[model samples]
Target: MTHPMALPVVRTLNTDRHRVALQVFMVVVVAHWAEHLAQAVQIYVLGMPTSEARGVLGLPFPWLVHSEWMHYGYALVMMVGLILLRPGFVGKARTWWTAALLIQVWHHFEHLLLLLQALVGTNIASRPVPTSLLQLALPRVELHLFYNAIVFIPMVVAMIKHGKPSDEELAAAPCRCAPAKV
Candidate 1:
Protein backbone atom coordinates (compact mmCIF):
# COMPACT_ATOMS: atom_id res chain seq x y z
CA MET A 1 0.00 0.00 0.00
CA THR A 2 1.23 3.48 -0.89
CA HIS A 3 1.13 6.26 1.69
CA PRO A 4 0.36 9.93 0.99
CA MET A 5 3.38 12.27 0.83
CA ALA A 6 1.55 15.49 1.73
CA LEU A 7 0.24 14.63 5.17
CA PRO A 8 0.37 17.65 7.43
CA VAL A 9 3.12 17.30 10.00
CA VAL A 10 2.48 19.20 13.18
CA ARG A 11 5.74 20.84 14.08
CA THR A 12 6.35 21.69 17.69
CA LEU A 13 9.44 23.16 19.32
CA ASN A 14 11.14 20.31 21.13
CA THR A 15 13.03 22.76 23.35
CA ASP A 16 13.16 26.35 24.55
CA ARG A 17 9.42 26.97 24.84
CA HIS A 18 9.98 27.86 28.49
CA ARG A 19 12.82 30.16 27.53
CA VAL A 20 10.61 32.03 25.13
CA ALA A 21 7.98 32.51 27.81
CA LEU A 22 10.56 33.75 30.32
CA GLN A 23 12.09 36.26 27.92
CA VAL A 24 8.64 37.57 27.05
CA PHE A 25 7.83 37.80 30.75
CA MET A 26 10.94 39.90 31.36
CA VAL A 27 9.92 42.31 28.65
CA VAL A 28 6.58 42.62 30.41
CA VAL A 29 8.28 43.34 33.74
CA VAL A 30 10.72 45.89 32.35
CA ALA A 31 8.11 47.62 30.26
CA HIS A 32 6.69 49.10 33.44
CA TRP A 33 9.75 51.30 33.81
CA ALA A 34 8.71 54.74 32.72
CA GLU A 35 11.80 55.45 30.62
CA HIS A 36 11.84 52.11 28.86
CA LEU A 37 8.21 51.57 27.78
CA ALA A 38 5.81 54.01 29.34
CA GLN A 39 7.77 57.06 28.30
CA ALA A 40 8.09 55.71 24.78
CA VAL A 41 4.32 55.52 24.44
CA GLN A 42 3.79 58.88 26.08
CA ILE A 43 6.25 60.58 23.77
CA TYR A 44 5.01 58.81 20.67
CA VAL A 45 1.41 59.73 21.33
CA LEU A 46 1.54 63.10 23.05
CA GLY A 47 5.13 64.37 22.77
CA MET A 48 5.75 64.72 26.52
CA PRO A 49 6.30 62.94 29.80
CA THR A 50 3.59 61.18 31.81
CA SER A 51 4.58 62.43 35.23
CA GLU A 52 2.69 65.71 35.37
CA ALA A 53 4.95 67.37 32.85
CA ARG A 54 3.63 70.30 30.91
CA GLY A 55 2.10 69.56 27.52
CA VAL A 56 3.83 70.19 24.23
CA LEU A 57 2.79 70.61 20.61
CA GLY A 58 -0.92 70.87 21.46
CA LEU A 59 -0.96 67.59 23.34
CA PRO A 60 -1.35 67.00 27.03
CA PHE A 61 1.26 64.75 28.57
CA PRO A 62 -0.45 61.72 30.09
CA TRP A 63 -0.37 62.14 33.86
CA LEU A 64 -1.64 58.60 34.25
CA VAL A 65 1.44 57.40 36.12
CA HIS A 66 0.72 59.66 39.05
CA SER A 67 -1.90 57.18 40.09
CA GLU A 68 0.80 54.68 41.03
CA TRP A 69 -0.22 50.98 40.65
CA MET A 70 -2.71 51.38 37.83
CA HIS A 71 -0.25 52.63 35.19
CA TYR A 72 2.31 49.84 35.64
CA GLY A 73 -0.47 47.27 35.73
CA TYR A 74 -1.74 48.51 32.40
CA ALA A 75 1.78 48.61 30.95
CA LEU A 76 2.43 45.01 31.95
CA VAL A 77 -0.76 43.94 30.23
CA MET A 78 0.22 45.80 27.07
CA MET A 79 3.66 44.20 27.05
CA VAL A 80 2.18 40.70 27.25
CA GLY A 81 -0.19 41.54 24.41
CA LEU A 82 2.70 42.77 22.29
CA ILE A 83 4.70 39.58 22.66
CA LEU A 84 1.74 37.22 22.14
CA LEU A 85 1.16 38.58 18.65
CA ARG A 86 3.80 37.59 16.16
CA PRO A 87 5.67 40.57 14.78
CA GLY A 88 5.87 38.68 11.39
CA PHE A 89 9.21 40.04 10.13
CA VAL A 90 11.25 37.83 12.45
CA GLY A 91 10.64 34.75 10.32
CA LYS A 92 12.28 35.96 7.08
CA ALA A 93 15.94 35.48 8.00
CA ARG A 94 17.86 33.35 5.52
CA THR A 95 20.59 32.68 8.06
CA TRP A 96 21.11 32.97 11.79
CA TRP A 97 23.56 35.82 11.31
CA THR A 98 21.13 37.55 9.00
CA ALA A 99 18.37 37.13 11.56
CA ALA A 100 20.63 38.66 14.20
CA LEU A 101 21.46 41.59 11.94
CA LEU A 102 17.82 42.22 11.05
CA ILE A 103 16.76 42.08 14.67
CA GLN A 104 19.41 44.66 15.61
CA VAL A 105 18.43 46.93 12.75
CA TRP A 106 14.74 46.78 13.62
CA HIS A 107 15.54 47.62 17.24
CA HIS A 108 17.75 50.55 16.25
CA PHE A 109 14.91 52.08 14.30
CA GLU A 110 12.48 51.50 17.16
CA HIS A 111 14.88 52.94 19.75
CA LEU A 112 15.90 55.89 17.60
CA LEU A 113 12.56 57.52 18.20
CA LEU A 114 13.25 57.48 21.92
CA LEU A 115 16.81 58.70 21.50
CA LEU A 116 15.60 61.79 19.64
CA GLN A 117 13.50 62.78 22.64
CA ALA A 118 16.33 62.12 25.13
CA LEU A 119 18.94 64.24 23.37
CA VAL A 120 17.20 67.15 21.74
CA GLY A 121 14.10 67.39 23.91
CA THR A 122 10.78 65.71 23.04
CA ASN A 123 9.91 67.90 20.12
CA ILE A 124 8.66 66.71 16.75
CA ALA A 125 11.12 69.16 15.17
CA SER A 126 13.99 66.93 16.26
CA ARG A 127 12.77 64.10 14.07
CA PRO A 128 14.37 65.62 10.98
CA VAL A 129 17.90 66.01 12.39
CA PRO A 130 20.32 63.23 11.55
CA THR A 131 21.89 61.40 14.48
CA SER A 132 25.38 62.60 13.49
CA LEU A 133 24.13 66.19 13.63
CA LEU A 134 22.98 65.90 17.21
CA GLN A 135 25.20 67.02 20.08
CA LEU A 136 24.16 63.91 22.01
CA ALA A 137 22.41 60.67 21.32
CA LEU A 138 21.14 58.19 23.86
CA PRO A 139 23.81 56.40 25.81
CA ARG A 140 24.20 52.61 25.47
CA VAL A 141 22.69 52.38 22.00
CA GLU A 142 24.81 49.31 21.27
CA LEU A 143 23.62 47.65 24.48
CA HIS A 144 20.02 48.14 23.46
CA LEU A 145 20.77 46.66 20.02
CA PHE A 146 22.39 43.65 21.66
CA TYR A 147 19.52 43.18 24.10
CA ASN A 148 17.00 43.21 21.29
CA ALA A 149 19.04 40.55 19.51
CA ILE A 150 18.89 38.32 22.58
CA VAL A 151 15.15 38.77 22.93
CA PHE A 152 14.29 38.22 19.28
CA ILE A 153 16.91 35.66 18.26
CA PRO A 154 15.26 32.53 19.59
CA MET A 155 11.80 33.49 18.35
CA VAL A 156 13.23 34.36 14.93
CA VAL A 157 15.18 31.11 14.74
CA ALA A 158 12.09 29.10 15.66
CA MET A 159 10.02 30.94 13.09
CA ILE A 160 12.57 30.39 10.34
CA LYS A 161 12.80 26.69 11.07
CA HIS A 162 9.22 25.75 11.97
CA GLY A 163 7.03 28.16 9.97
CA LYS A 164 3.58 29.35 10.98
CA PRO A 165 0.49 27.20 11.40
CA SER A 166 -2.15 27.18 8.68
CA ASP A 167 -5.71 28.37 9.25
CA GLU A 168 -7.02 24.81 9.35
CA GLU A 169 -4.50 23.73 11.96
CA LEU A 170 -5.28 26.73 14.12
CA ALA A 171 -9.02 26.34 13.77
CA ALA A 172 -8.89 22.62 14.52
CA ALA A 173 -6.77 22.81 17.66
CA PRO A 174 -8.87 21.84 20.73
CA CYS A 175 -12.00 23.04 19.01
CA ARG A 176 -14.70 21.35 16.95
CA CYS A 177 -14.80 22.42 13.34
CA ALA A 178 -16.71 21.50 10.20
CA PRO A 179 -14.75 19.25 7.87
CA ALA A 180 -13.15 20.95 4.90
CA LYS A 181 -14.45 20.05 1.44
CA VAL A 182 -12.09 18.10 -0.73
Candidate 2:
Protein backbone atom coordinates (compact mmCIF):
# COMPACT_ATOMS: atom_id res chain seq x y z
CA MET A 1 0.00 0.00 0.00
CA THR A 2 1.24 3.50 -0.80
CA HIS A 3 1.60 6.13 1.85
CA PRO A 4 -1.19 8.73 1.61
CA MET A 5 1.26 11.50 0.76
CA ALA A 6 3.23 9.43 -1.73
CA LEU A 7 0.21 8.46 -3.81
CA PRO A 8 -0.63 11.82 -5.37
CA VAL A 9 2.98 12.90 -5.60
CA VAL A 10 4.00 9.72 -7.42
CA ARG A 11 1.01 9.95 -9.71
CA THR A 12 1.52 13.62 -10.63
CA LEU A 13 5.24 13.35 -11.01
CA ASN A 14 4.92 10.27 -13.17
CA THR A 15 2.14 11.74 -15.27
CA ASP A 16 1.18 15.36 -15.89
CA ARG A 17 4.33 16.92 -14.45
CA HIS A 18 6.80 14.33 -15.65
CA ARG A 19 8.56 16.41 -18.25
CA VAL A 20 9.02 19.43 -16.01
CA ALA A 21 9.90 17.21 -13.07
CA LEU A 22 12.62 15.57 -15.14
CA GLN A 23 13.97 18.94 -16.27
CA VAL A 24 14.13 20.17 -12.69
CA PHE A 25 15.78 16.99 -11.52
CA MET A 26 18.37 17.17 -14.28
CA VAL A 27 19.19 20.76 -13.36
CA VAL A 28 19.79 19.78 -9.75
CA VAL A 29 22.02 16.86 -10.77
CA VAL A 30 23.99 18.95 -13.24
CA ALA A 31 24.44 21.74 -10.71
CA HIS A 32 25.88 19.31 -8.19
CA TRP A 33 28.21 17.91 -10.85
CA ALA A 34 29.34 21.43 -11.76
CA GLU A 35 30.11 22.18 -8.13
CA HIS A 36 32.28 19.09 -7.82
CA LEU A 37 34.05 19.93 -11.06
CA ALA A 38 34.65 23.47 -9.86
CA GLN A 39 36.13 22.21 -6.62
CA ALA A 40 38.45 19.83 -8.50
CA VAL A 41 39.59 22.58 -10.84
CA GLN A 42 40.20 24.90 -7.93
CA ILE A 43 42.42 22.34 -6.24
CA TYR A 44 44.20 20.65 -9.14
CA VAL A 45 44.31 23.32 -11.82
CA LEU A 46 44.41 26.58 -9.86
CA GLY A 47 46.54 25.26 -7.00
CA MET A 48 44.12 26.69 -4.48
CA PRO A 49 44.63 25.70 -0.87
CA THR A 50 42.52 22.69 0.01
CA SER A 51 40.80 24.50 2.84
CA GLU A 52 39.97 27.42 0.62
CA ALA A 53 38.72 25.34 -2.30
CA ARG A 54 35.04 25.69 -1.55
CA GLY A 55 32.99 25.61 -4.75
CA VAL A 56 30.86 28.51 -6.03
CA LEU A 57 28.15 28.34 -3.35
CA GLY A 58 30.63 27.22 -0.74
CA LEU A 59 32.63 30.37 -1.35
CA PRO A 60 29.73 32.30 0.10
CA PHE A 61 28.99 29.64 2.70
CA PRO A 62 32.36 28.22 3.65
CA TRP A 63 30.96 26.15 6.50
CA LEU A 64 28.94 24.25 3.90
CA VAL A 65 32.16 22.71 2.71
CA HIS A 66 32.84 21.31 6.16
CA SER A 67 29.27 20.34 7.03
CA GLU A 68 28.55 16.65 6.73
CA TRP A 69 24.85 17.42 7.11
CA MET A 70 24.97 19.46 3.90
CA HIS A 71 26.58 16.62 2.02
CA TYR A 72 24.13 14.13 3.46
CA GLY A 73 21.22 16.35 2.54
CA TYR A 74 22.32 16.55 -1.07
CA ALA A 75 22.80 12.80 -1.27
CA LEU A 76 19.37 12.19 0.17
CA VAL A 77 17.83 14.62 -2.27
CA MET A 78 19.54 12.91 -5.19
CA MET A 79 18.27 9.54 -4.12
CA VAL A 80 14.73 10.79 -3.63
CA GLY A 81 14.73 12.46 -7.02
CA LEU A 82 15.82 9.24 -8.63
CA ILE A 83 13.12 7.25 -6.84
CA LEU A 84 10.31 9.70 -7.44
CA LEU A 85 10.86 10.02 -11.18
CA ARG A 86 11.73 6.39 -11.78
CA PRO A 87 8.26 5.22 -12.79
CA GLY A 88 8.19 7.71 -15.63
CA PHE A 89 10.98 5.77 -17.30
CA VAL A 90 10.22 2.69 -19.41
CA GLY A 91 12.10 -0.01 -21.33
CA LYS A 92 15.76 0.84 -22.07
CA ALA A 93 15.48 4.18 -20.29
CA ARG A 94 14.15 2.39 -17.24
CA THR A 95 17.09 -0.02 -17.25
CA TRP A 96 19.69 2.73 -17.39
CA TRP A 97 17.81 4.85 -14.88
CA THR A 98 17.66 1.90 -12.51
CA ALA A 99 21.44 1.52 -12.86
CA ALA A 100 21.93 5.14 -11.81
CA LEU A 101 19.51 4.74 -8.91
CA LEU A 102 21.27 1.64 -7.61
CA ILE A 103 24.64 3.36 -7.70
CA GLN A 104 23.12 6.35 -5.90
CA VAL A 105 21.81 4.04 -3.18
CA TRP A 106 25.42 3.14 -2.38
CA HIS A 107 26.54 6.75 -2.66
CA HIS A 108 23.77 7.79 -0.29
CA PHE A 109 24.83 5.14 2.18
CA GLU A 110 28.38 6.46 2.13
CA HIS A 111 27.13 9.98 2.84
CA LEU A 112 24.99 8.64 5.67
CA LEU A 113 28.04 6.98 7.18
CA LEU A 114 29.93 10.25 7.02
CA LEU A 115 27.06 12.13 8.66
CA LEU A 116 26.81 9.56 11.42
CA GLN A 117 30.54 9.75 12.03
CA ALA A 118 30.34 13.54 12.24
CA LEU A 119 27.42 13.45 14.64
CA VAL A 120 29.12 10.94 16.91
CA GLY A 121 32.39 12.87 16.83
CA THR A 122 34.32 9.78 15.80
CA ASN A 123 35.76 8.71 12.48
CA ILE A 124 34.71 5.31 11.13
CA ALA A 125 37.69 3.24 12.28
CA SER A 126 39.14 6.02 14.41
CA ARG A 127 41.68 8.08 12.55
CA PRO A 128 40.68 11.70 11.94
CA VAL A 129 37.62 13.39 10.42
CA PRO A 130 34.70 11.38 9.09
CA THR A 131 35.80 8.90 6.44
CA SER A 132 33.69 6.68 4.20
CA LEU A 133 34.46 3.04 3.43
CA LEU A 134 35.64 3.91 -0.04
CA GLN A 135 37.75 6.71 1.37
CA LEU A 136 39.88 3.91 2.73
CA ALA A 137 41.35 3.57 -0.76
CA LEU A 138 40.57 6.90 -2.39
CA PRO A 139 40.69 10.45 -1.06
CA ARG A 140 37.35 12.06 -0.26
CA VAL A 141 37.38 14.54 -3.13
CA GLU A 142 38.24 11.88 -5.68
CA LEU A 143 35.73 9.45 -4.22
CA HIS A 144 32.91 11.96 -4.49
CA LEU A 145 33.95 12.94 -7.98
CA PHE A 146 33.99 9.29 -8.97
CA TYR A 147 30.59 8.67 -7.40
CA ASN A 148 29.03 11.69 -9.09
CA ALA A 149 30.45 10.71 -12.48
CA ILE A 150 29.18 7.15 -12.39
CA VAL A 151 25.69 8.22 -11.36
CA PHE A 152 25.56 11.11 -13.81
CA ILE A 153 26.77 9.08 -16.78
CA PRO A 154 24.04 6.47 -16.46
CA MET A 155 21.43 9.14 -15.77
CA VAL A 156 22.42 11.02 -18.93
CA VAL A 157 22.18 7.89 -21.00
CA ALA A 158 18.75 7.20 -19.58
CA MET A 159 17.61 10.73 -20.40
CA ILE A 160 18.85 10.37 -23.96
CA LYS A 161 16.98 7.12 -24.36
CA HIS A 162 13.92 8.58 -22.68
CA GLY A 163 13.91 11.48 -25.09
CA LYS A 164 14.09 9.33 -28.20
CA PRO A 165 11.89 6.47 -27.11
CA SER A 166 10.43 3.98 -29.59
CA ASP A 167 6.98 4.43 -31.13
CA GLU A 168 5.44 2.10 -28.60
CA GLU A 169 7.35 3.75 -25.81
CA LEU A 170 6.12 7.17 -26.91
CA ALA A 171 2.55 5.94 -26.97
CA ALA A 172 2.77 4.52 -23.47
CA ALA A 173 4.89 7.27 -21.91
CA PRO A 174 3.06 9.84 -19.82
CA CYS A 175 4.71 13.07 -20.88
CA ARG A 176 5.73 14.72 -24.13
CA CYS A 177 9.47 14.56 -23.79
CA ALA A 178 10.20 13.22 -27.25
CA PRO A 179 9.67 14.73 -30.69
CA ALA A 180 6.12 14.75 -32.06
CA LYS A 181 5.23 11.48 -33.77
CA VAL A 182 4.62 11.86 -37.51
Candidate 3:
Protein backbone atom coordinates (compact mmCIF):
# COMPACT_ATOMS: atom_id res chain seq x y z
CA MET A 1 0.00 0.00 0.00
CA THR A 2 1.28 3.49 -0.85
CA HIS A 3 1.91 5.85 2.03
CA PRO A 4 -0.30 8.93 2.15
CA MET A 5 2.64 11.31 1.66
CA ALA A 6 3.98 9.24 -1.22
CA LEU A 7 0.63 9.13 -3.02
CA PRO A 8 0.66 12.79 -4.07
CA VAL A 9 4.28 12.54 -5.11
CA VAL A 10 3.56 9.48 -7.23
CA ARG A 11 0.50 11.04 -8.82
CA THR A 12 2.40 14.24 -9.63
CA LEU A 13 5.15 12.36 -11.36
CA ASN A 14 2.99 9.72 -13.02
CA THR A 15 0.24 11.77 -14.66
CA ASP A 16 -0.27 13.90 -17.78
CA ARG A 17 0.64 16.82 -15.57
CA HIS A 18 4.23 15.56 -15.56
CA ARG A 19 4.32 15.58 -19.36
CA VAL A 20 3.10 19.16 -19.53
CA ALA A 21 5.58 20.21 -16.88
CA LEU A 22 8.38 18.51 -18.80
CA GLN A 23 7.42 20.38 -21.96
CA VAL A 24 7.54 23.70 -20.13
CA PHE A 25 10.85 22.84 -18.54
CA MET A 26 12.26 21.94 -21.94
CA VAL A 27 11.27 25.35 -23.30
CA VAL A 28 13.26 26.99 -20.52
CA VAL A 29 16.16 24.70 -21.26
CA VAL A 30 16.09 25.62 -24.93
CA ALA A 31 16.01 29.30 -24.10
CA HIS A 32 19.12 28.89 -22.02
CA TRP A 33 20.82 27.06 -24.87
CA ALA A 34 19.94 29.89 -27.22
CA GLU A 35 21.55 32.36 -24.87
CA HIS A 36 24.74 30.34 -24.80
CA LEU A 37 24.72 29.92 -28.55
CA ALA A 38 24.15 33.61 -29.02
CA GLN A 39 27.02 34.42 -26.74
CA ALA A 40 29.25 32.12 -28.75
CA VAL A 41 28.21 33.78 -31.99
CA GLN A 42 28.82 37.19 -30.54
CA ILE A 43 32.37 36.25 -29.67
CA TYR A 44 33.39 34.05 -32.59
CA VAL A 45 31.23 35.35 -35.39
CA LEU A 46 30.71 39.01 -34.58
CA GLY A 47 34.17 39.58 -33.07
CA MET A 48 32.78 41.07 -29.91
CA PRO A 49 34.92 41.27 -26.83
CA THR A 50 34.24 38.52 -24.33
CA SER A 51 33.23 41.09 -21.71
CA GLU A 52 30.85 42.81 -24.13
CA ALA A 53 29.36 39.66 -25.66
CA ARG A 54 26.38 39.31 -23.38
CA GLY A 55 23.52 37.60 -25.21
CA VAL A 56 19.89 38.76 -25.55
CA LEU A 57 18.92 39.01 -21.88
CA GLY A 58 22.52 39.60 -20.96
CA LEU A 59 22.43 43.00 -22.62
CA PRO A 60 20.65 44.29 -19.53
CA PHE A 61 22.15 41.88 -17.04
CA PRO A 62 25.72 41.63 -18.15
CA TRP A 63 26.83 40.33 -14.77
CA LEU A 64 25.01 37.03 -15.29
CA VAL A 65 28.14 35.27 -16.45
CA HIS A 66 29.92 36.37 -13.29
CA SER A 67 27.12 35.26 -11.00
CA GLU A 68 27.75 31.88 -9.42
CA TRP A 69 24.29 31.96 -7.94
CA MET A 70 22.69 32.13 -11.39
CA HIS A 71 24.82 29.29 -12.73
CA TYR A 72 24.16 27.08 -9.71
CA GLY A 73 20.46 27.84 -9.79
CA TYR A 74 20.19 26.79 -13.44
CA ALA A 75 22.12 23.60 -12.79
CA LEU A 76 19.92 22.76 -9.84
CA VAL A 77 16.77 23.40 -11.84
CA MET A 78 17.92 21.14 -14.66
CA MET A 79 18.67 18.33 -12.23
CA VAL A 80 15.36 18.66 -10.43
CA GLY A 81 13.37 18.93 -13.65
CA LEU A 82 14.99 15.81 -15.07
CA ILE A 83 14.35 13.86 -11.86
CA LEU A 84 10.76 15.00 -11.48
CA LEU A 85 9.78 14.21 -15.05
CA ARG A 86 11.67 10.92 -15.32
CA PRO A 87 8.78 8.77 -14.10
CA GLY A 88 6.67 9.71 -17.11
CA PHE A 89 9.20 8.43 -19.63
CA VAL A 90 9.32 4.80 -20.74
CA GLY A 91 11.31 2.46 -23.07
CA LYS A 92 13.66 4.25 -25.49
CA ALA A 93 12.56 7.62 -24.20
CA ARG A 94 13.43 6.54 -20.69
CA THR A 95 16.90 5.45 -21.78
CA TRP A 96 17.61 8.75 -23.51
CA TRP A 97 16.15 10.76 -20.67
CA THR A 98 18.34 8.84 -18.22
CA ALA A 99 21.36 9.71 -20.31
CA ALA A 100 20.52 13.43 -20.14
CA LEU A 101 19.83 13.17 -16.41
CA LEU A 102 23.18 11.54 -15.74
CA ILE A 103 25.02 14.22 -17.69
CA GLN A 104 23.08 16.98 -15.96
CA VAL A 105 23.91 15.42 -12.60
CA TRP A 106 27.58 15.80 -13.38
CA HIS A 107 27.00 19.31 -14.71
CA HIS A 108 25.20 20.16 -11.47
CA PHE A 109 28.15 18.89 -9.46
CA GLU A 110 30.48 21.13 -11.43
CA HIS A 111 28.31 24.15 -10.77
CA LEU A 112 27.99 23.18 -7.10
CA LEU A 113 31.74 23.03 -6.76
CA LEU A 114 32.08 26.39 -8.44
CA LEU A 115 29.45 27.93 -6.21
CA LEU A 116 31.11 26.55 -3.09
CA GLN A 117 34.41 28.02 -4.07
CA ALA A 118 32.82 31.40 -4.74
CA LEU A 119 31.06 31.30 -1.39
CA VAL A 120 34.36 30.49 0.32
CA GLY A 121 36.12 33.37 -1.48
CA THR A 122 38.35 30.98 -3.34
CA ASN A 123 38.62 29.93 -6.96
CA ILE A 124 39.52 26.80 -8.80
CA ALA A 125 43.23 26.51 -9.61
CA SER A 126 43.65 29.83 -7.84
CA ARG A 127 41.97 31.67 -10.67
CA PRO A 128 40.61 35.13 -9.86
CA VAL A 129 37.01 34.12 -10.61
CA PRO A 130 34.87 31.06 -9.93
CA THR A 131 35.84 28.13 -12.07
CA SER A 132 34.46 24.69 -12.75
CA LEU A 133 36.75 21.65 -12.84
CA LEU A 134 36.65 21.59 -16.63
CA GLN A 135 37.33 25.31 -16.77
CA LEU A 136 40.98 24.49 -16.23
CA ALA A 137 41.16 23.21 -19.81
CA LEU A 138 38.40 25.23 -21.49
CA PRO A 139 37.33 28.76 -20.61
CA ARG A 140 34.12 29.03 -18.59
CA VAL A 141 31.98 30.29 -21.46
CA GLU A 142 33.10 27.58 -23.86
CA LEU A 143 32.90 24.86 -21.24
CA HIS A 144 29.31 25.74 -20.43
CA LEU A 145 28.46 25.75 -24.12
CA PHE A 146 29.94 22.28 -24.44
CA TYR A 147 28.08 21.08 -21.36
CA ASN A 148 24.76 22.43 -22.59
CA ALA A 149 25.21 20.91 -26.02
CA ILE A 150 25.92 17.42 -24.70
CA VAL A 151 22.99 17.48 -22.30
CA PHE A 152 20.59 18.96 -24.87
CA ILE A 153 21.33 16.39 -27.57
CA PRO A 154 20.13 13.48 -25.47
CA MET A 155 17.20 15.46 -24.19
CA VAL A 156 16.06 16.20 -27.74
CA VAL A 157 16.46 12.54 -28.61
CA ALA A 158 14.33 11.56 -25.65
CA MET A 159 11.63 14.01 -26.66
CA ILE A 160 11.59 12.60 -30.18
CA LYS A 161 11.37 9.05 -28.88
CA HIS A 162 8.65 10.04 -26.47
CA GLY A 163 6.55 11.65 -29.20
CA LYS A 164 6.63 8.57 -31.39
CA PRO A 165 7.01 5.78 -28.90
CA SER A 166 6.87 2.10 -29.73
CA ASP A 167 3.59 0.30 -28.93
CA GLU A 168 5.10 -1.23 -25.80
CA GLU A 169 6.50 2.09 -24.76
CA LEU A 170 3.18 3.84 -25.32
CA ALA A 171 1.49 1.22 -23.19
CA ALA A 172 3.99 1.80 -20.38
CA ALA A 173 3.80 5.59 -20.42
CA PRO A 174 1.55 7.20 -17.85
CA CYS A 175 1.24 10.31 -20.03
CA ARG A 176 0.28 10.88 -23.66
CA CYS A 177 3.54 11.70 -25.35
CA ALA A 178 2.65 9.19 -27.99
CA PRO A 179 -0.06 9.81 -30.55
CA ALA A 180 -3.59 8.80 -29.62
CA LYS A 181 -5.00 5.56 -30.94
CA VAL A 182 -7.59 5.96 -33.70
Point to the candidate with the largest TM-score: 2
lDDT of candidate 3 over 24-128, digit per residue (tens): 998999899999999999999999998899888889887887788998999999998888788788898889999999999999999999999989998877898
TM for every model, in the order presented, reads 0.23, 0.94, 0.92
Instruction: Estimate the lDDT of model 2.
Output: 0.91
For model 1, what is the error of residue 153's alpha carbon versus the real structure, in angstroms, after optimal superposition?
4.6
Candidate 2 residues lying further than 4 Å off, grouped into runs, are: 2-6
Worst 10 residues of 1 by lDDT: 5-14
**Model 1 alpha-carbon miss at residue 46, Å:** 1.2
Estimate every model's Cα lDDT from 0 to 1.
0.38, 0.91, 0.87
**Candidates in descending lDDT order:** 2, 3, 1
lDDT of 2 by residue, 75-142 (tens): 99999999999888888898999999999999999999999999999897786899999999898888
Instruction: Assess candidate 3 and give its lDDT.
Output: 0.87
lDDT of 1 by residue, 71-168 (tens): 33443344343333322123232244244444534444444544444455554445533232222454332343344446456544644333433454
Ranking by TM-score: 2, 3, 1
Candidate 3's displacement at residue 6, Å, is: 3.8
